[model samples]
Target: MSDDVRDSLIPYDEIVQDALRAVVGRVLSQIVGYDSLPGEHHFYITFKTQAVGVDIPAHLIAKFPDEMTIVLQNRFWDLKVEQDHFSVGLSFNQTPSILTIPYASITAFVDPSVDFGLQFQVSDDDDTQPEPHDEADNDRPEVISEDGSNVVTVDFGKKR
Candidate 1:
């Protein structure tokens, strides 16, 4: 392997990122089709709160200024998936709210039931990393274990 790397004309990283985001959309779309999560499958989707195309309540944005994670296991409704985003009704602090989240805003998606997860690179629109914030703690979801055998994390750092 050569240490000296050249910049490629094709934006391979962006392409792969888009494809992976599509996976999230496709998965949610399938769930919408069935109108229920199959077996023990569930999802914990984390996204940038202030990202473009994200339509969340003001209180939620205030609580999670940087990022927030939403669980889609139980106690959720009106799940809808679109070409670039998805919306779902969830209760936070006993208040029901509908959040529209763009796939590009998602940083992580995990199905703890199967110990499967995917971490995505942030979009070009945002250059800063998300600051640590308190957990949403909206729904009392089952705890995820420490095992990470099925997690896929792709980082397009500088090539050496």
Candidate 2:
């Protein structure tokens, strides 16, 4: 048998990405009515700042031109999750900002409280152009897994 694998007609990568993004939506949906997070469960959501359908303040766009990670912990409000996107209110440098992000713009999601994480490949054709951005320092502790049990990473780039 040859070592060639046939290209799939079905867009499995897009399908799987959509499904995984749904997981994020579902999780957020469950907590929309809650007053607070249950027992230390919080989320670190990272997304492309310049992705189409993403809306943020001009200051934030200038600071995080390529990507930004937001912590959904204390002091977050107005979290509205829809079929294709989510919007929330967060504070940055003592300034309040409202951000709306499409699920397709998300590149990573992590709940370090449970050592669970998901990483996605940003599509090259998604109209994302990198620009100069201020390097915001993130001090979250890294959760390392030796057994490789609770992390999901998907890469759909075709091999030559």
Compared with the true structure, all predictions reach lDDT values of 0.82, 0.81
How far out, in Å, is residue 154 in model 2? 1.1
> Model 2, residue 57: what's the lDDT?
95
Tens digit per residue, CA lDDT, model 1, 43-138: 889888888999999999998998888888767888999999999988888999999999999988888788888888785554676676666784
Candidate with top lDDT is: 1
lDDT of 2 by residue, 100-156 (tens): 999999988888789888878778665555665666643244443556579888778
- For candidate 1, the C-alpha RMSD (Å) to the true structure equals 3.1
Off by over 4 Å in 1: 1-5, 33-36, 124-127, 138-148, 158-160
* Runs of candidate 2 exceeding 4 Å displacement: 1-5, 126-133, 137-146
lDDT of model number 2: 0.81
What TM-score would each prediction reach against the true structure? 0.84, 0.86
